[model samples]
Target: MKILIIEDEIQLVQSISEYLQTENYTCEYALTYRQAVHKVLKHNYDCILLDLMLPGGDGMQILEEMKRLKKMDGVIIISARGAFEDKISGLQIGADDYLSKPFHLPELAARIYSVVRRRNFGNSNIIDENELQINLLAKTATINNVELSLTKKEFDLLLYFISNRNCVISKNALAEHLSGDIAGMLDNYDYIYAHIKNLKKKLNDAGCRNYLKTIYGSGYKWEI
Candidate 1:
């Protein structure tokens, strides 16, 4: 899933970005409110980690703008202000969850997962797509009651595709989702080809029809 972190603390931002990257989440950062607004208006994200106090402008203003745009982006407010009123105001303004500063990274990750699960995955632990079944919590996949041993990237790739089924996904977008922000520095998207090829082979071998299609000269599409 794609996450935007609107935090001002450099060290905290880096640490959170690194941790989420390890968890297979694509992260983008904005240290100031202006940057945050720009990103929110420009791109779509699964969730946003927003800090209440920010330089240039209050983070709540950014949230208000997001709502004005009618964006369905999920937001989790992270602030040093733990007052009851602050939490209430955030929720009243449409924040999905609130996290106080000095919180555990694991806890934050869990909350983010919960919010995304509720918003995108119907708050279910398992996602079913035709003959394919995925245990989101366990991070496992089965087709026709047969399990496939997949690498971490392979599993994540499959999950992303299935979650966005019938949508055309560019190669760059796929790489960014799978590899995070640093994917841009890569010399080539050759690894994407390798992963897609391997995933297709595995699924086909497991008696699943190849649902992945190469949108020649553009990207890929996973359709029924």
Candidate 2:
């Protein structure tokens, strides 16, 4: 999943990014209100770690912008301000969860997983898509009662594709989702192609239909 971290503290941002990356999450950053607003407007993320205080503007304004635009991206306010009023206001403005500054990285990861899971799976840890079943917590996939030995990246790619099934997904979006920090510097998408090929082969070997379709001169679509 993709995450946006909106915080001005360089050290905190780096730490969060590194920790989340280890949890198999792709992260992007916005150190200022303007940058945060711009990224929120231009791209879609599974979750956003928002800091209430920002350089250019108050982070509450970002919440308002999201509300105005009717964006459904899950947001978790991670601010140093632990006031009761701040928590209430953030939830009232549509944040999914609130975490104070002095929190553990594992807890923060857990919250992010909860938010993304609720947003995408609607209270279920297991995703059932046709004959394909995925246990989100275990990060395992099975098709037609046969298990596939998929790499972590392959499993994640499969889940992402299935979640967004029948929708056209660009190579750039996949690259960014799969490769967090290195995405911005990517000059080619060969790695994506390799992963897709391997995933398709594995699925096909398991007697699953090839539902992933390539759009010539465009990107890919999970036709299922």
Candidate 3:
């Protein structure tokens, strides 16, 4: 999953990004309100960690803009404003959850997980797509009840595809989702090709149909 962290605190952003990375989440950050707006306009994230007090504008304003854009990305207000009214306002605006500052990293992660789950999978941890079954808790994908031995990256890629099934996902999106921050620095996408190839082989070898398709110069799609 991918997250956008909109906060001006440099240290907090770094710490949160690193912790989320450890949980296999791709993170992008914006330090200013303008940057945050630009990012939200340009890309799709599974969740957004928004701070209310921003450099140029209030985070509530950003929430308004997001609502106007009709974006469905899950949002969690991670602000120092811990008042009951602040929490109520955020939830009323569209935030899925509110996390006061000085909070535990694990708790933040759990909240993000819950929000993303509610948004993407209707709060279900398991995904059943025809003969393919994925247990999000176990991080396992099985075909006809036979488990496939997949690497972490491979499993993540599978989930990404499954979640966005029937949509043509660009290679750039896949690369960023896999490499996270380093994706911006890398010039080559050979790694993506290699992983996709391996994932395709594994699934096809396990008596699964080739649901994954390449769209010529566009990208790949899961058309099942």
Candidate 4:
């Protein structure tokens, strides 16, 4: 999934981004409220990790703006202020979850998964689609009770397609989802083809139907 981290602490931001990246999540960072707002306006994010205190403006104001735009993006508030009132206000303002500072990275990761699950996958850890079963927490996929070995990229691609089933996903969109903002720097999306091809092949080899389709000049679709 693609995540936006609106944190002012450079070390914390880098650590969180690196940790999430290791788990196959594409991350973008914004150190100030202005930069955060610019990113929210420019790109689509699966979830946003927002810090309450920020330079230039408060993160609550950013949340208000997002709600005004009807963005429907999931948000998790992370702040040093651990007061009950702060948590209450965040939830009242539509924050999906809250995490106090000095929290464990793994705990933060789990919270992000929970928020995304609630927002996109019906709040379930196990996503089942007929013969295909995916354990989001374990990051494993099984076809007809048989585990299919997949590279991290292949697994992420499959999950992305499944979550957005029936929607036509353009190559550029897929590239951006997989690589985040840096996708724009690439010359071509040849890597996307490679990942999709490998994922499809692996699934088919494991007795899964060809649910992934290529649309000539358009892109791909996951027709489950």
- lDDT by residue (56-98, candidate 2, tens digit) is 9999899989999999999999989988899999999999999
The per-prediction CA RMSD against the true structure, in angstroms, equals 11.5, 11.9, 11.9, 12.5
In candidate 1, residue 109 scores what lDDT? 67
Candidate scoring better on TM-score of 3 and 4 = 4
Clashing pairs in 4: none
TM-score of each candidate structure, all chains considered together: 0.57, 0.57, 0.57, 0.58
lDDT, candidate 4, 29-132, per-residue tens: 99998999999988889999999899999999999898889888899999998778989989998999998886656557757866788778763679888899
Residue pairs whose backbone atoms clash in candidate 3: none
Q: What lDDT would each prediction earn against the true structure?
A: 0.84, 0.86, 0.86, 0.85
Model 1, span 92-125: residue lDDT tens: 9899998887665555665787688878876467
Put down candidate 3 lDDT per residue, 1-224, tens digits, no spaces: 99999999999999889878866789999999999999998999999999999999999998988998899899999999887899999999899999888665555765787688777876367878888888887889999999999999999888777655566677877876677557779988889999999999999999888899989987888887
Report the Cα lDDT for residue 200, model 3: 96
lDDT of 2 at 184: 71
Query: How far does residue 22 in candidate 4 sit from its true spot (Å)?
Result: 1.2
Candidate 4 lands at a TM-score of 0.58
